[model samples]
Target: MKKKGIFVISLDLELIWGVFDKVDYKEKSSYFKNTREVIPEILDLFSEYNIECTWATVGMLFNSTWEEWKSNFPENFPEYQNEGLSAYAYGESIMSPETEFYCFAKEIIEKINATPSQEIGTHTYSHYYCLEPGQDLQSFEVDLKKSIEMARAMNIELKSLVFPRNQFNSEYLKVCKKLGIENVRSNPTDWFWQDTQKDSLKDKIFRTGDAYLGPINKSYSISSLKAEKDKPLAQKASRLLRPYSNNKILNKLKIDRIKSEMTYAARNEEIYHLWWHPHNFGSNPQENLKDLQVLLEHYKRCHKEFGFQSLNMDGVNKQFQNILRN
Candidate 1:
């Protein structure tokens, strides 16, 4: 039973907290509103397919109002060398009724909590950047503690974490383990996926091309994870489910590449983990949902033919633990 193929899906639910450093709120306000509107629909699709997903939400998003958000800030804030990278600084003048949809999402979090087989994981208290400069282990721990505290306030115990921006730092796993995180979404082993914070134009080009051309075998055998004794198992990501594209031919190729990879994992009895941000669907929710439905349908076929199973990060971690115990 353990040899069967495993399928894992994770979502980084950051609202604007994830992109505040990069995008302007006023210009992308409608985009954020669309994202809030589409989350329920996405959850409904997951239910229809009996899919289990891990939503690694930013802790700041749990607040219903601006005042609540301000009160929940960590005692010790991360002091990044570049001040623009600080969410706390950005939040100073950003909260209002106009930006309410982008800043707070407590109601959306409740909807996800109500969904069956869905795991609510933390994306850190402030979407903290682990690999960024001027941030230390002590500060990271403070952020994680704040995240756990906020989730607990909502009756949620976060067992899984997905670092913001795929900044996969092995050093931080110890902090996560100490704070009760069972697993974390690590970056893929391929060179193109490594050191994402310092990503180069060449690497970016290759990553995008790999999505359509199949430059590498993204899936891996579960036995590999068994070899590691790390407490917070590093559940490596296989691919990012790139958002809807207007170019029809390119979109088809991207979908084909994903199908081919899933087929490989299913046939070889390996693990295939796919992830993306919920806001990636904001611009074109219908098209994104259509593509997602196609992928889920492929997953059903793979499950029927090869015993492929859909599990969240928590489920995958539990399965790995069982193997170790046996």
Candidate 2:
């Protein structure tokens, strides 16, 4: 049973907190709004296809109002060299948590809570950047504590964490382990895909090309995770489910690459972990959903042929733990 192919999907469910340092809120309002709108449909697709996913949401998103957010803010914050990178001084002016403000997502969270086949995981209390220079482990612990508190307030148990921007610090896993995080989504093994604070231009080009070509395939075998004993279950991500594009030929090729990888993993009884943010589908939800359907249909065929099974990060780790215990 453990040798069967495993399919895992994890979503970095940060609407704007994940991109505040990069994108302007006003310009991307529609993009965020569309993201909020399509989450239900995504959940529906998952339910329809028997797929389970872990949504590593920013803990700040649990606030119903700006005042609630301020009240629940973590005591210590990540001390980034750039002040703008820290989200502590926000919410004093231009506050709007009612209609999908930049960071708040109480309503969206409620939707997720009501959905089935989902695991609620933390993306840190403030989208904490682990690999950043100014952040300390103690501060991260504070953030994770706040995350646990916020999720507890919502009657949610967070057992998995996907680091913000894939900035994984090996030392931080102890903090997560102490806080009961059973697993974390690590980046692929290759240097090009290593977790870094600053992605170089060459890295970006390689990643972009890898989406359409098999430059560095991210898929891995289930045995790959069994090797990590001390750290949180390192469920490495196979590939990022990039957003749909207008270019027909390029899109087809990208989907083809993903399908090929998925087929390979299924046939080999390995694990294919695909992840993305809900906002990636914000611009063209329909088109993105269409492509997602193609992947799901492929997964269905793989399941029928090779005993592939869909599991969230938590489920995968649980299965591995059971296997180890036996």
Candidate 3:
């Protein structure tokens, strides 16, 4: 009998400007640009494993940056016009267009499109915060529609989505379905600010918490200044202890989490959705990648023992839909 396992790797592809609007891009472009090198390495690794992964890219990244690269640097950066740039430059206002930033992002988007065996998904038009209660549903819908349209403009077909900030609004699911999206990567109950409806059996859910599987603990908080100050000690300890914390630990803990939520999936199995920004790997990417590699290897081992198989978000949702039909 084959062991049951599911592996879902979701990427939130956005520029540092989109994430950190406060930073001065003109002076700090290199700092923001440095973080992006890890992305190609990640793509390479996924390619090596023949991994079918989901890239929840910000549509503006493609339209703005990629388009610019094509028009501005056609000869030297032919790939940039279609592929996507490593970084982008944007202003303070969220909705405002920053042409320079778009130029960079467009190249990056094109590059991602060129990669084979990868699925491009939606992250939202401007990386909106859906969790903010004041954000009206209409506005959310409009932005969601815009994101889908932007992808269409790029001639890219979007099949999956991962909410920005893990802010899964139930209403957004309807928007996704209407847009022909087949699946979404959502947070599990154990993560912070999870939705009450997420516990229901009807929705397709994925568990996500970086610390839970890696050197850190899910419960650890970094919000407080005090916590940040004290984290170095814990970080050092985690580095020393990580080698000993093997697949056995991951299997035991992750399986228990899945079993607890098995009923929510109606025993059909829920996607163990693991996701994070590619930039997150930048701080100590090699170490982070090593940890991820260990987890992936463990997932492969588990696939042989359990019945679960690794899937991109679309593949997982298709399987779930098939199960529902029966």
Candidate 4:
């Protein structure tokens, strides 16, 4: 029998919290509104395709109201040198909205919980930036502990983590291990994908072009998905599924590149991990969802013809542990 290729999809499910430091949420209200509406449709498509996925959610999003959110904060907070990076500060600055749709997402989370084959993982309590200056490992630990605690309130055990901003701090792995987190998503080994406080303009340019042109191998062998004992297994992500663009030629090129990479993984029995923020689909939602359906359809074909299997972050980690046992 041939080995099966693995496909993993993770969504960084941070609402406004993910981008408040960089973008003006009030100006992009329509964008966030579209995100709120499109989430269920994304879930529906996942159900239709029997796709398994992980939602690495920001811990504060578990709260339904601003009061609840305030109540759930960790004892210690990340005091980034740049105060703008602090979600706590941002949260306090904004007047509590009548409709807490943007910041709080307990309702959407429940929808995820109700969905089958969907795993809820932590994206840190306040979306803490591990690599950023002025934040220590101790602070990261408390944030992570708070994340696990909040998930438990909803009867969910968070065994997987996706670092906020793809920071992928190796030193923070100890904190994850201490908290019993079994898996984490790591950045690709390529130079352009290096985890850093900020990427150089040259690196950013290459990453953007690479999405449309095929110069990188975005797949990994099963044997490569391993971790040192007592550490959370690091599963490197292959690609970020960029949001739909208006340029038809550019959009086609990007999707084709992803499809080609998926095919290579299937034939080689390797791993292909695709991730994106739910809000990326906010602006061009219908077109984005349509493109997503195309990729899922491609996955279905690969499943039938080449034994490609879809698994969430935790599911992939379990297989890694099983290999260790054997």
Per-residue alpha-carbon lDDT of candidate 2 for residues 127-158, written as tens digits (9 for 90 to 100): 88888878899999999999999899889989
Evaluate all candidate structures by whole-model CA lDDT and list the values in order: 0.90, 0.85, 0.53, 0.90
TM-score of every candidate relative to the true structure: 0.97, 0.95, 0.64, 0.97
- Candidate 3 residue 190 Cα shift, in angstroms, is 2.4
Off by over 4 Å in 1: 226-230
Winner on TM-score between 2 and 4 is 4
Candidate 4 lDDT for residue 100? 77
User: Which parts of model 4 have CA positions greater than 4 angstroms off?
Assistant: none
Q: For model 2, give the 10-residue run with minimal summed lDDT.
A: 91-100
Clashing pairs in 2: none
lDDT, residue 161, candidate 2: 99
**What is the TM-score (0 to 1) of candidate 2?**
0.95
Residue runs of model 3 more than 4 Å from their true location after superposition: 1-3, 21-31, 65-103, 195-270
User: Over the stretch 238-273, how does candidate 4's per-residue lDDT look in tens digits?
Assistant: 999999999999999999999999988988889999
Question: How does model 1 score by TM-score?
Answer: 0.97
Better of 1 and 2 by TM-score: 1
lDDT tens per residue, model 1, 40-143: 99999999999999999999888888778888878899999988989899888686766767888989999999999999999998899888899999999999
**What's model 3's overall lDDT?**
0.53
